[model samples]
Target: MTLTHRLLSPLIVALAFSAPVVTHAATDPSFVLTATSKNFDNYFPSYLANGYFSTMTSVRGSEANLAYMVAFMDYAKDDIARPAAIPGWSGIDYSTGKSTAGEFWLNRTLLSDKAFSDYQQTLDMHNGTLTTRYRYTDDSQKSTRIEITTFVSQADTHLAATRITITPEFDGSVQLSFPLNIWAPHQPRFPIGKMTGDEMLAAVAANNMSVTEPVNYRTADRAPVWYHGDTNVSNDDGSTKDLTLQLDGKAEQGLHMAEAAAIELPKGIKPSDITLDKSTYQLALNMKVPVHKGHAYSFTKYVAMSRESWGGDASATAALAKKARSTGFDKLLAAHQTAWHTLWQSDIVIDGDAKVQQAVHSDLYYLLSNSTSGTAWPMGACALTPNYAGHAFWDSDSWVFPALLLLHPDRAKPIVMFRHRTMQPARERAIQYGAKGTMYPWEADPETGIDYTPHFAYGVFREIHVNADVAIAQWQYYLASGDSAWLKANGWPVIKEVADFWVSRVSYDKANDRYEILHVTSPDEAYDDVPNDSFTNAAARKALDIATAAATKVGASPDPQWADISKKMYIPFDAKARRHLDFDASVPHDKITWMGSSLAWLMYPNLDLPMSPEIRKNDFDFQLEELKVHGNDPNEMMMVMLATAAAEVGDGKTAGEWLQRNLVGFLKPPYNVRSETASNNAGYILATSAGFVQSLVYGLSGLRIDDNGLTEAYAPALPPTWKSLTLKHITFRGKRYDITVDRDAAGNAKLTRKAL
Candidate 1:
């Protein structure tokens, strides 16, 4: 579809059908261009081009449900208590086998009834492109049926890349059985090997595996295994019989295995009860399956059969598996890739800065790789990184959603729906905190929907603004996508609940004749426990306005109560400081500063506060003087926000400077990869990509959207060394626009925009 038609068709139809017009636009193409940077190539090669397998380690449980488990019999060890070690093993120092006595040993010793630890794992690749087979046995020679299903996409060209749920069944006494043999082209490696039986037992004892919290134990054991799988495994196995085992370490040699014994079931219950039902268990496997540059590999495996003794019929499982195989898995994976392609296809390229192009693609790839299927929470809000222990934060809705909406509106919807799915939990949180409306958590455990904000001081200060942030994101989604069904169903209810909360939560300041948000912190945590926080007030007002507007549009009654409260919401301004206060009475310190001044509260959307040229200059000066700490804190998001703000105020010179600083200072150079933290950072390369987008859209092109329409203020301030720039698919005023800024042969500069 043409960019103009794709963006404006819905609005035109809505206007014809008596619906309100939503003036949303796609990203600019010049800004969306692609390039090869050593920095990006070194840090995020998976995003640069097409590939088959991408492994995801579960930062939280929501991500953990996507892997499988494998066990094996230790034939070399005369006693199952101590399995013989393979040669030349080197991986994690942790023990793998179970142990009872010889507590100080490093091998598996069966003690306290815990079964020997089994490796939990998973395989991910393009759907239908590759097939995987595992060899194993069942009790008494009963038939073992394996079933397989794909969860993400069903397209033939794309891979089913998300969660792969696995269930295993067996016959006989409910003893532990190791069924999986190989992951096809890739062989498994034992990291801890070669210790004596006593040492193995001691190591297992020291590890302290727990029975009740099986998930934790499974995760800890599986992480080391997969880490080895990704980093060490090679495709060349000598033969099927010589499966290329790497167990040279003493711990592996002394590893013990438990005798095959099943859990005892009650009489009259079928053997199936003792196996698949009563013995239901889960494991998390995160292994990086290698992929050739241009070739696609599909990951396939059978969820091994249910035992015959329990009338094990694979019909239902098989049917579901076939359905996934036929349609869901491949289609989902393809759609995800298509989503990324759509980003590249609709990208607005910038001509001069090669770094900008690389950064943009990297960000787009990161967002695609980490997002989930509809109704599933996005990859813990932090996008597969270990920062914040994989917890979902307010940034998912406030910052991430907005960026996605402009670039890829279709994929952006699911993220908003995820918030709707969690509404009930949010409501419950509100009641727990003695509030009238929903109070979303500042940080949430992705799988459990549990809040985990630790109290630092006197009392647990609830970041009440999260509820407002959610409401605004949903409203923005509605505006961008023009999905009335979503608005009426998902958006309306959330809007009402959040609006209700604001109404009940705000207190009337009789002296000032304004509604006050008391004891709230703005987006920047520099100032806390302040009254009438300007950022919070601005967001609350925006939320109230959107809620009222959406309510009116959907034929819902506009609550007059909201009007009274909205009229009174306080937005504090500092006259002497000559800049907006972070919060009411926010004291500016000589040394104490916000972590990232670029992400100050006023910069976010729906807040509707503009930074004047004078104010922008002052804020830039303040940030440069005080906020540029070592440059690694707050991850890459800080750079993105800073670039965005710099672009906003027509300071192209400053914006370009900031962009280059991030690229060279943190994103490039000696490290040459994106880092999660200062010391133990992994190569996560999305932040710089996002920064590139922000620099172009918010900086040079000056695109801003609102109810009236899209507005463009030309502000191209390229460095003197650069000659020209061009961008395509820059959306504004309900139209697709292509813009170019270049210096003519005569040295005169020109800016041109044409409706697509």
Candidate 2:
């Protein structure tokens, strides 16, 4: 389907979208997100990622000035424990800090100093390529048109390339200098504190506080720079320098990272002509471009970033850059395009609404950009950025995994593999907490499965739902893929351990004859230290049930206690209101906070709880009213979930309205990328993106995944303004299918499924 729609809402359309100038006619105009060089600044960043590595640039022409790259594997130890500091509760390092993998850029000051005109940057969402074009005129009025095409190769995960082509009106030299630097920005280790910045600095100067030392270079010269530092520091009270102490390490101690670039010069320029400028933590490649009038000179720079976590050494990383340089740019571009094309095969097609189609594609595109097969690390909240300290939470299992599992199961493996890889740590954590089974942390360390939740947050000790969340994600993957080997090897163990954790956690109330999980935080995160949270109990019950069945699948004896616990699990409900209570003690029909309500999970993703239409409607209505309240900030994921709930409750108008509000409120153009909150707090939230896509695929299509396999739970509710919604290449049980939902002549929603 051709994507050619204007924004549905005029108020939400960005300035770039309103007057889009497609400088590249060969590329699809609908897939291209374009903005002027002036649109970019320190605050407004434009970025590209290829699952392995990502680069963020401030402007159109170069990756200079406030530009950096982050590899998925690059992480440093968070400031948790040190010799002089108050001992951290968890002895292990969280390793949640996402240090800069590398930075490579042409000298922006030198290039932008010359007079330039018609500068524009366009990101092709369909092909995963970014192209920037401009014409520079010298003092003699001689013009040179320069076009730079950049892409992190999806085909070859470790390789990234930038192709620079220049055509000049006069024969002259264009000096080009490229620098590679590996560094991270300075920020407080503990961000939340009561003390003033100046006071904290004074305390540090007075030897009352301590900070992580600066990074020390181990290897630096003409080759890739390798460095590490000590993150351990002295602790302070919540009111003091703990929040003021700046973390100085660029790379973590155990994470071996090496980055270098190889330049493929034009035919006339010799390799030996380029000069190398070296520093302690940086390397520069300097040369001059020999420009001939009306003769185009093309040069490609290949960058390779390797980390020990992702299976690469210094020699291997350098060899990758060299190999990519030898392979040439055209072949690499073609391979990258092919990889993207394969991913786009499983796409959401919205008929009669071009803007919605574009938005959906952009969301899926970003998720795909941040994923790859055979990796055990979870995608962070801000997929490529260091926002939220790059920690993976329940967001990965509950929101992000579903969409990927349905569309691209191979890519979805990492989300579950990460859990399996960290299960040992989960067991160790449970032992430390005096619990029987595995307990996944609320906020996990990417490298080691350490509980990264700060000691102050109750989630560090009380939020236990992540265990079940991980188990449910694993079972869902099994249901979708039907991979028996994976079930026995990776899936069953996690599921069984989660069941064991719940077994050890619940209290046996013989008087009430029920199993109760006490003092836990639900997905809502508002009601802490509560008993029997509706979502938590339901999820845990479902995990137990899955474990019982998985035992049979893996040819292991079923744990009898799992069935008993699941059968007697006490889920909070208000009989009079006919709605599941947020927690056992939550008052029915009380004034509610405008934040997200976890009750929606029962209707959308889980579907394990037994609820009548009246109950679902009551809960959804109450939550929707809470979201509508003006003062509180409601996240985008819940809005998407509520929209799906609206559809399930036969409220098509409400569903359509909420979906529209989400598109307008959370997603920003010209790229239609989603921020964490409606207030534009954090950019490129993959959870929000995943939830939006899930709302369309599973919500609008009425498809539900369970042990019985993929089945339509009910008739889909088509959005009022939508002509039709079709999901292509939906893989279930190793078969691909296309499902389309549209209104029949009678104005009733109809769903058609075709096997491919």
lDDT of each: 0.43, 0.66
Reference-based TM-score, model 2: 0.83
Per-model C-alpha RMSD:
17.4, 11.0
Model 1 residue 368 CA deviation (Å) reads 1.2
lDDT of 2 by residue, 523-621 (tens): 565556778887888888999999999999999998899999999999888788788777886533243433546678788774446678788889887
Which candidate achieves the best lDDT against the true structure? 2
Deviating ranges (above 4 Å) for candidate 2: 1-28, 37-43, 65-116, 137-143, 184-250, 270-273, 309-311, 586-596, 629-631
Model 1, TM vs. native:
0.58
Residue 361, candidate 2: C-alpha displacement in angstroms: 0.8
Work out candidate 2's RMSD over C-alphas: 11.0
How many steric overlaps does candidate 2 have? Answer: 1
Off by over 4 Å in 1: 1-343, 372-376, 385-387, 454-461, 586-599, 606-608, 628-635, 668-673, 676-692, 713-756
Per-candidate total of colliding backbone pairs:
81, 1
**Residue 66 error for model 1, in Å?**
10
lDDT of 2 at 678: 63
